[model samples]
Target: MKTILAILAGATLALAATAAPAQTLKSVKDRGELLCGVSKGLQGFSAPDASGKWTGFDVDVCRALAAAIFNDPNKVSFVPLTADERFPALKDGKIDVLSRNSTWTLEREAKLGLLFTAINYYDGQGFLVRDARKVTSALELDKSKVCVQAGTTAESTTKDYFAANSMALELVTLPTSGDLVKAYEDGKCDTITTDVSQLYALRLTMAKPADHIVLPDVISKEPLGPVVRQGDDQWFNLVKWTIFAMINAEELGVATNTLDAAVKSQKPEVKRLVGTEGNYGEQLGVSNDFVVRIVKAVGNYGESFERNVGAASKLGIPRGINQLWSMGGILYAPPVR
Candidate 1:
């Protein structure tokens, strides 16, 4: 009888655990603003303008979520955080979402009690050296002093990469990206190593931007995206689908300029995407036209990318792997229906 009672107790506890609710959506709704954690100032990703208005690829993700929930892109509060403070702020509920330029790794999701929603940017680590160095590849970076942020994957990855290539590495660690940039500019390190996208962004901030060149060789795969505190499946789904919806919109050729025509499209995929055919958005705790609102306010993924980081912007970084699956790159999103 004791063994049977023990089995019943275990089953009851399991049910109770599964029954615990996710409060993120309700808490954000009640709070009247979606608090988002962003980088201190990564230009193409997340940064505030002179007027203190946040605008960039990562910032738009937060604004897209706000539009989906409240039909207002301005219903978000941007919290600028450093590399070390980002995860803790999200875990402590100080921010509803972390749209910082953080890479999604196994240890981060499994060990840090956080969930990476989706890969918003496909990036890889690379080296940036002075143009006068006449260096064309990463292999040319032997016996160099590299500048990198202290508390980042790039720090360990730099060591591993140099060790694997039989190159001697002298690391110059700084507390933040800004510090690392200053160190590199002040001739503290021979080379700067970080995500290629970051290298592009940081280089533009330098006094002599044209004097540096980013090497073509990429070392580590850095799949960067938005993150949320673990155990909130509802909030997770909301963020994941928001990005997917934008990608899908781009794949279907539903852009902001042609939004009205997209809504009137007779094709089934277009109909489903523009809310003329399905209740998909309702299932995710929003109205059927949630994607419409997102596209209207922030625009689809391609528009966001172009406006912030692509050829239209000062960064001029090509779409490359961030392009849709249909367009040579591997960025595949699920169907909205």
Candidate 2:
């Protein structure tokens, strides 16, 4: 009986070890294309052009993952999801990864059984108002009607901020970002509140983009990043490290423009990043040159940022805190070594 029990236990252990890679990665590999959840139509983060081509910062993250996995950035299906639908889609296995600009909060992970991989954008709650309103600060708008998207941290944060400051707030809560913007444009509210990054994006959609101004006051911390389902350590690590690889590439000055030289780099960190020195990508269940694939597809984090939402883009938002740690921002990644 003792021999039989020992043999059964060993068999159980073997099965567990075999299942260690988790189902998400295997399913993605089998499907031949990654299902990435993105915002419904947030320009600069994730939006479909007139030709139905998706492009933006968040879209690039999904493309980077596809490039890492399939060596083809185009091997991805972008699923547009609303704020309320995003989490459920991810939880229901409708999407493999959520690259929507979602805020990372404790309640989301602990309550929803999801995991935020990493904070790709550091943001804050801010207000946007028509420049003609003559309001330069969020605190100055007393008894103002504020438009915010429902089912988002922005709605709750706006409420808390108003109450804390002893200001009267007429809240106009909308179901989607489009609704919020429409409400704001239709004079349904005196101001709109959301993440500072989002506010910039929203402003661009206005009839006269220069007529509105994003307030300088940042009320709450909003660390936005990619999210994956919990319990899939392999998938979680892969997504997290994918973002890290982008950040590290930017720090190492290895971008899409310099990718050819990066492959032959002899620097210890550069070698590991370019896959000439170590098997870091293989350990993540991808090709050893996964970083090369990612960089080639989306350039690096900074490149994606500048191209989609930074000064080079229509938004013209400053790099601010999203810059690399060495360049006075909090953006830092673990060494590939």
Candidate 3:
């Protein structure tokens, strides 16, 4: 009798622990909104318009997830935060996912206890300098004053590169991107260091974009993507595959305007994605129409990105590293079927 009681108790505890992963679906359904963390007005990335509506590449990630959950993309709350605050916000459950332009690093993954869903943008760090400086290479800026954000991975990366190369560069710490830009404009710093995408975004807003240029020096490979708190494999998988659905939609030629026609698509991939064939969404605690809702809400991965920050946008960034693998870039998604 004693042995049986002990065995039953152990089994019950094991089942209880195993069942915790299944609760996130119910909790999100009860909440009715996806809390999406974004940046504090990073132009093409995340910002509010005159109508006070948030729109950008990062914002689309949030809205897309909301569509997957409630079948309504607009059912989302955008929580804008700074670089220093975004990590803590996600970890504390203040936001469901960090959809900002956050880099995926082993230290952040293993040490900070965070998980990256996928690498949406294959980016790198670079330098932006005044055109009159006539300096094209990063190594040529020896002893040059450089303005960088006070606390960012970009700053540390810049320092490491300079130190390893035995180059003496003055590091001018700025509290924000705006401040760093101002310092560079005022010639307080001969150059400014940041991610190449951010450098272009900032340049587009400057009074004289022609007077400044970003060098062709990509110092580091920054695979940036969405982030969520550590633990809870089910929650992580939901965010991960939702992003995958968007990417896969683009690869399969599915879009918001073309979704109606796609329902009739006899293609195996399209059928699986549009809920005409598979039950993948059920595993993620969402309806079978989750991918359709996401595609219809925000088009596809390429559409959302290009509209916000691609060649047609003010940022004028080419889809060099972000293009699909078939297109000679690294963007790829696993098989949906």
Candidate 4:
């Protein structure tokens, strides 16, 4: 009797654990809004224009997830957050998923009890300095002060690079990226260090964009992506597959412009990705054409990247490692089936 009762208790606890709020995809639909945690303001990443419509690479992730669940990409409310507040916000269930440029680290995953769904950006740490400073290599900044944001990959990367070469450098730990930029511009630090993608974004805020240059040396890998609190397998699957669908869509040549034609094809991967082959969406508690909606509503991964941070945009970030496997970079998706 004691053993039976223990098994029953354990089963009850397991059931209760999985019954958290996000399980109700219907609640999100009824509420008519998906609360998303994102950067307060990072151009070409997640920032609202003057018209108040949130636009950027991260916005598309939130929008795509919203479209998958609610069938409306616009049914999302952006919750601006800082680097420090990102994980806490998601863990507390304040936001469904964190869409910030959060790096996936073992410490954050195991210690914080979170999971990285997919990498939206494969980047690395770099330093940016005034063009007039004329410092070409990071190795030359021996005694320079670098403006770094606290509680981010920047801090550890900066420390690692400096220690590895026995280079002596002053550290200026700023509270936020905005503060980091301000401090750098104020001459509080000779250089500001961050992801190479962001270094370009940061330069756009300067008075003279031509006055600064991003160093060519990329110090550390920054595989940035969305994060979800642990124990929500259903929610994790939705977020994870949504990203996969986008990538798979691109690989299968299913773009908004050619979506109509691509949908008619009997290709296994295309059909599975666009929701024509299987009831993949039903498994995720979303509409049958969830992947289709994501592709049509926002765009595939390549389109989103090009629109926000590619050569056409102000940031002009080349899709070096973020490109698809066929194109030579590491970006690839598992079989949709």
Q: Highest TM-score: give the candidate number.
A: 1
Runs in model 2 lying further than 4 Å from the true structure: 1-21
| Model 2 lDDT per residue over 1-337, tens place | 9999999999999998876755788899999999999999999999998999999999999999999999999999999999999999999999999999899999999999899999999999999999998998888989999998877999889889889999999999889988988898988997999999999999988899899999999999999999998878889999999999999999999998999999998899999999999899999999999999999999999999999999999888899999999999999999998
Q: Write the per-residue lDDT of candidate 1 for residues 1-337, one digit (tens) a residue.
A: 9999999999999998987767798998998999999999999889999998999999999999999999999999999999999999989889999999899999998889899999989999999999999999999888899999866899999999999989998999888889888999888998999999999999999999999999999999999999998888889999999999999989998888989999989999989988899898888888888889999998999999999999999999999999988889989998976
Give each model's whole-structure lDDT.
Answer: 0.92, 0.93, 0.86, 0.89
* lDDT of the structure predicted as candidate 3: 0.86
lDDT of 2: 0.93
Which model scores highest in lDDT? Answer: 2
Candidate 4 lDDT over residue span 187-306, tens digit each: 899899999988999999988889999999999989999998787778888899989889988888899998898778888878877778889899988877898899888999999999
Q: What is the TM-score of each candidate against the true structure?
A: 0.96, 0.95, 0.93, 0.95
What residue pairs clash in candidate 3, if any at all? none
Model 3 lDDT tens row, 220-330:
988889998776788888889988998888888899888998889999989999888889888787888889999888889999888999976888789997888888888
Which candidate, 3 or 4, has the higher lDDT? 4
Over 4 Å off in model 3, which ranges?
Answer: 1-19
**Backbone atom clashes (below 3 Å) for every candidate:** 0, 0, 0, 0
lDDT, ranked from best to worst: 2, 1, 4, 3
Note the residue pairs that clash in candidate 4. none
Q: Which window of 10 residues has the lowest lDDT sum in candidate 1? A: 16-25
